[model samples]
Target: MSRIQLALNVDDLDSAVQFYSTLFQADPAKRKPGYANFAITDPPLKLVLIENPGHGGTLNHLGVEVESSPQVHAEIARLSQAGLFTEEQIATTCCFATQDKVWVTAPDAEPWEVYTVLSDSETFGTAPILATGEAVPDDEAIAVCCGAAENATAPGAPCCG
Candidate 1:
């Protein structure tokens, strides 16, 4: 199975690392001059952070996983139905690999990319890093919208998964 990947821009690498460590509850799998990454196995997610020279703050991009090309198309349709903005797929090469995917612009204007690999030989290079989604201010709302509500303890809403 493929993993869900996420990347974000930070103002301070050191502070971001400490904060993320508390958030992810684990040390970073890879740390560099202005970046840090974590591979979360349990949920099958990959996360990375990069220092923004001019910009400062959190809330990057969003990414979702799909199995095949058909799945990607179906998800695009589904997200469109939900009123999400999606960009057309443009054939290109990145990270030395060919990708078939679309970019999504959420209601909040955050960029989200969805892609499928035609080949895995492009695993080298800078690695396909992405931007952050779900802005910082929306963190609490995201928790609630994503079902993190503490008061949502009824049969319908489960407490903190």
Candidate 2:
């Protein structure tokens, strides 16, 4: 099965966690210092919240969480065939998971990813390493995830905002 993933940047992690917990009637499936994720089955959604003090209370990114790595790769190929530019991160970490992801930008500049999680990681994985084992620099990795690099938007501007 696949799920729609909605990632949001919030000012307060604890508060957002509390509110979403009540709203969804389920506690987060994963929680860390600056992030929380809920694997909600009732509504078939993957909700993620990250605390970013500089955020504008807008969306961080959107994604499709598929069941397998092949699904991710297939989506990547499909997007490329449709002429959308994509950036692939294989075995890289993000949002506390080791994931294989392909990121693309919507027409409205919203960042979207097709990803499959391989394993859990201890930290919020921001520094995504390339398939060739080259690590993307900190600032550049952050820009890619935060919509600055792909969306052609100012740094810190919301991807969907």
Candidate 3:
């Protein structure tokens, strides 16, 4: 199964969780220090809340959560074939989980990813590969989940993932 994932930045985690839970009539599937997610059944939505102070009520990133890594690989190929730049992150950790994913940016610069979670993690994020898709040293990676790749047209770029 697959579900669209929405990651939102909030100033307060507790407040956002409370409101979303009340609105959806469901609790978070996972809760961490500053992160929470809901696996909504009716609408099949993966709503994620990120405690990013001063960026309340704004989108953090967007994604589609698939069932496995093969699905992620398929998206990478499909997006690339369609002439959209693609950045593939395999076995990367983000949002307190290990994931296999591919990223792309919309015409308006909105970041989107097709991903599958492999397991939970204790870390919040890892250094995404550089704009060249090279696995540079951690010190050299750009620190944005949205992508440093937007500046370039060619495939392969950086992201906060």
Candidate that would win on TM-score: 2
lDDT of 2 by residue, 74-104 (tens): 9889999999898887886666778888888
Model 1, position 144: C-alpha lDDT score:
30
Please provide, for model 1 over 1-161, each residue's C-alpha lDDT reduced to its tens digit, 9 standing for 90 to 100: 66777766677879888997888787887675555667677767767665654444554455654567777787778878888766645343432334556666655555566766555332222212225643324223322322123322222211110
lDDT of 2 at 29: 95
Where does model 1 exceed 4 Å of error? 1-4, 12-37, 80-84, 95-97, 119-161
Local lDDT at 9 for model 3: 76
Q: Tell me, by lDDT, which candidate is best.
A: 2
lDDT of each: 0.53, 0.76, 0.75
Q: Which sections of candidate 3 miss by over 4 Å?
A: 128-146, 149-161
Task: Give the per-residue lDDT of model 3 (tens digit) for 65-108.
Answer: 99999889988988899999887778877677888888888888
lDDT of candidate 1 vs native? 0.53
- Taking all chains together, the TM-score of candidate 3 against the true structure is 0.82
lDDT accuracy of residue 9 in candidate 2 = 83
